[model samples]
Target: MKVDWSPLKHELGEWRAAGLTLPLWWRDDDAVAPTESLARLESLSATSGVPVHMAVIPRDATRSLADDLSDQFIPVVHGWAHVNNQTEGKKAEFGMGRDAHAARLDLQQSMARMRDLFGARLAPMFVPPWNRFDAALLPTLAEFGIDALSTYLPRQTATPIAGVTQINTHIDPIFWRGTRGLVPPDDLVAQTVALLQARRTGMQDNAEPLGYLTHHLVHDADIWEFSQQFMQEMCDGPVRLYRHDTKGFS
Candidate 1:
């Protein structure tokens, strides 16, 4: 389906007129090992000049995956394992139903395993599985050397706790509950326009880099095309790409 990107383009133009720069970042989750799909993602990032932050699952991550990472790919922890610990409700590894002590141990182990695999390449960020994390675990994140927390939607505050920074993805192209393919192009474009409008009009936190979330392993042709187009537009627009080290999260 053809997408009308004029709305997003107009919003970007407004940002330029205001002499504002939109901070943008890309994150792809659930990476375990090297695969053809992953190679495509890496190639896209290298070609588009937009770095992708790979949310590598600690338990399933491999040394080869770490070796496959280029400067364009940044590795961050994506929970202990992608397993859902909840007996009821939605899937989540770090949900409220989990025991606090067990959760802490999981967090500790997740960091250790990721550090072992990725070494110093791993960013000090935690992305809870299914983007669901218990608020009670917030304070303990810093103890495990986590500097940032990422999830879905706009973050309510820059700092949910004293030491950790909260940065979240505002747009996800997938229709997870539906066909597991791309969401309707019109809806996706409209959502992007709305998000940018909110930030441009001072209704949202513009400081938090606008994040593009993707699942490379599950992406089909449509999703890949949309991702490339969207990344190209953002790269060509008034924006600054976010970098973990230079962003002061450390």
Candidate 2:
């Protein structure tokens, strides 16, 4: 299958040599339609030398694509079933600012379950559903064998958890509306450019890895092209793409 990599591997290697890395973490392996989108992203990302992180859930009510990309990027657990049992106004409450103890227990089991199934290939990173989480869950998450937690919010707690890690993205390309499918194209592009600029002007810190979230099924032709171009331009000298492992990153 063919893939669409924005800034190819050759350039990525160059960026690595220069000490700047753009860690691109893609979420949503549990979407209703996972086959075509996930496959296309994996094919494209692998070809371009971009490390795509796949978040898998045991029972997504659909096929599991984790085992399919053994030759491609790394795999992590997005969440079990990617389901949100949070309250009506707070659907994506995996990590907000409440329920420390319960969240810990919930994640503990998820971690063990994922390890039993995925083995060492599973990195200890957790991306909550809806790309939204509560801030109060991080420190507690650390105790549940979570090495890193990835979220879509730009602001996170400053408290440190010795060995645990944290990664997040400010720009989300996927479109969503009140738990709906995907959003429109123009809105996605606008968000993309805004985040790209945020990274360029140092609005986003160097310590925190940059993020871009995608849902391949929402492939509106115009938005895809714009996304491709926006990322390409953002990847020039001032912009670099790199990935950092939980333990490896300082």
**Predictions in order: lDDT:** 0.90, 0.57
As for candidate 1, its clashing pairs are none
- Best model number under lDDT: 1
In candidate 2, what are the lDDT values of residues 1-250, reduced to their tens digit? 1233333444444555766655444443444334766676666565544566666664442324444555455667666666676666667747455366666666777777677656777777777877776656666667766777776666454234666566776666544544344345445545654554454456765556667666566655544554555455445434445444444431
In model 1, which regions exceed 4 Å deviation?
Answer: 246-250
lDDT of 1 by residue, 195-221 (tens): 988998999999998999999999999
- For every model shown, the clashing-pair count is 0, 11
Each prediction's TM-score versus the true structure? 0.97, 0.70
* lDDT value, residue 150 of candidate 2: 75
Which structure among the candidates has the greatest TM-score?
1
- Candidate 1 similarity to native, TM-score: 0.97
Question: What is the clash count of model 1?
Answer: 0
